[model samples]
Target: MTELEADCSRCVGLCCVVPAFGRSADFAIDKPARTPCPHLGGDHLCTIHEVLPERGFRGCTVYDCFGAGQFVVQDLFGGAAPSPAMFDAFEVVERLHELLWYLADARSRPEAAPLHDEVDGLRDRVSAAARSPHDVDVTVLQSRCGALLDEVSGLVRAGGPSLRHADLAGRDLREEDLYAADLRGAVLIGADLRGVDLGPADLLGADLRDARVAGADLSQALFLTRLQVRAAR
Candidate 1:
C-alpha cells in the first residue's frame, strides 16, 4: 500500500487541520476546518496521540487520507504551512483521492476483470488530479466513483450475509457473527461491533464512523483498512 496508504512521516498534519469534527463519544471537543485541533501541538504533532482513545479523541485514529495529506502538503502545497485556501482545496482533493483508493481496490479484484481498464483510467485521472489542487473536481469524481462502486459491488456481492445499505446505525452488535458478510455501502454509524468476527467480510464503502470495535476480529476483513477501523471505536 505504499503511496496508497497514509505515510504520516511525509505529511504536514493536514488531517488534524483540514477536517472539522464535533464533540461526541468519538471526539473530545469540537474543531473547525483550517483550525488546528486543541490537542495538536505547535510542531504539528497530536498532543494526545498516545492516549487519543482514552482522551475521547478516538476519531482521530481512524482517519486515513490515503496519502492525500502528504501529496497536498509536499507536492501541491510545496511543503509550506497550509493556508485556509489550501485546506479548502485539500478537502476537495481528499474526496477525489478516496475514490482512487476504492478504484485501486476494485482493480485488484479478479472478479472485476471486465472493469479493470476503466478502473485504471479512472485511477490515473484521480491520481494526477490529487497532485494538483486546481484540477480536483469533487462532484464528478463522486459520481464516477459511485457508478464504479455499484458495478464492482455486483461482481463481489455473493450470498454470504449480505447487509448492503442496511440501516444498522447506532445498533449494538457486539460479539455477533458477521463472517463473510456483504457490507458494501452499509450504514454502520455508531454501531457497536466489539468482538464481532468480521472474517472475510466485504466492507467497501461501509460507513463505520463512530462504531465501537474495541475487540472486533477483522483480521481477514476484505477491503478493511486501518483508516476504516480507526473511524470506529
Candidate 2:
C-alpha cells in the first residue's frame, strides 16, 4: 500500500482487537475483545473522531495499526468482509501484530522484525486455526503468544543507554539497565523492558501494557505498577 493508503482508515480497526483496555490511568472505561467501542460504528469508524482527547480517548487517538489489519483482511482473507472465521483470525493476528510492534519498538527497528522461533511456532498454530472451517480456541494461542513475546523481549531490552521518559516505543531494550532514572509518564506502548533494571527510579504513571518487563526490576519506582497502565496506547 502507498503511504497515504497505508493509514488506518483502510483497515477494519484491528488494533482494537489485538490489545485490551480497562478503567486505568489512561483509559476512562473498560472494554473487551471484538466489542465495538461505544463511539465506534458498524462501519468500524470512530464516531468521536475529532474530539477523542476531550472525550477521554487519548489512547485511542494515538493508536496506529501499521496497515497490518488491512493486509490481513484484504490480502490474506481475499478482500471479503470479515467472517466469523476471519474475525477469529483477526483477533489472533491483531494481537500478534501488536506484539510484533512491541518487539520492534523495544528493539528500535524501522520495520517489524521476524518473530522469534517460539513466537513463529505460535504463529503457525494461529495460522492453522485460521484455516479451520470452525473458529479455534484463541485463548490458548493468546496465552502462548504472550509468553513467547515475553521471552524474546528480554533480549530486546538489553544494551541501551539509560533512557528517561524516552519515546522508545516500538524499540527493544532487553536486559538493559535503566536503573534509578526519570521515566515519568513516558510513552512506552510497544517497548521491551524484559530483565531491565528500573529500581529506585521514577516511572510515575508510565504506559507499560504491550510492554514486556517480565524479568525486569521495578522496585521503588514511584507510582509504577500501583498506578494503572493502559494498553493500546
Alpha-carbon local distance difference test for all models: 0.78, 0.56
Q: Could you report the Cα RMSD, in angstroms, for every candidate shown?
A: 3.2, 10.3
Error of 1 at 44 (Å): 1.3
Q: lDDT, candidate 2, residue 18?
A: 46
- Candidate maximizing lDDT: 1
Question: Model 1, stretches more than 4 Å misplaced?
Answer: 159-162, 169-181, 189-201, 209-222, 231-233
Per-residue lDDT for 171-232 in model 1, tens only?
Answer: 98875567768887899999998888886677877898889888888775666666777677
Show the lowest summed lDDT stretch of 10 residues, model 1: 150-159
lDDT (10s digit) by residue, model 2, range 1-233: 13212345566665565456887654678988656567766676777779877877777755554445676677678777656556666655554444343333323321225444444456556555544424556577657755554444334333233455678786787745676555656777778877777755545446775777677776544333322333422
- What TM-score would you give candidate 1 relative to the actual structure? 0.81
Pairs clashing within candidate 1: 62-230, 62-231
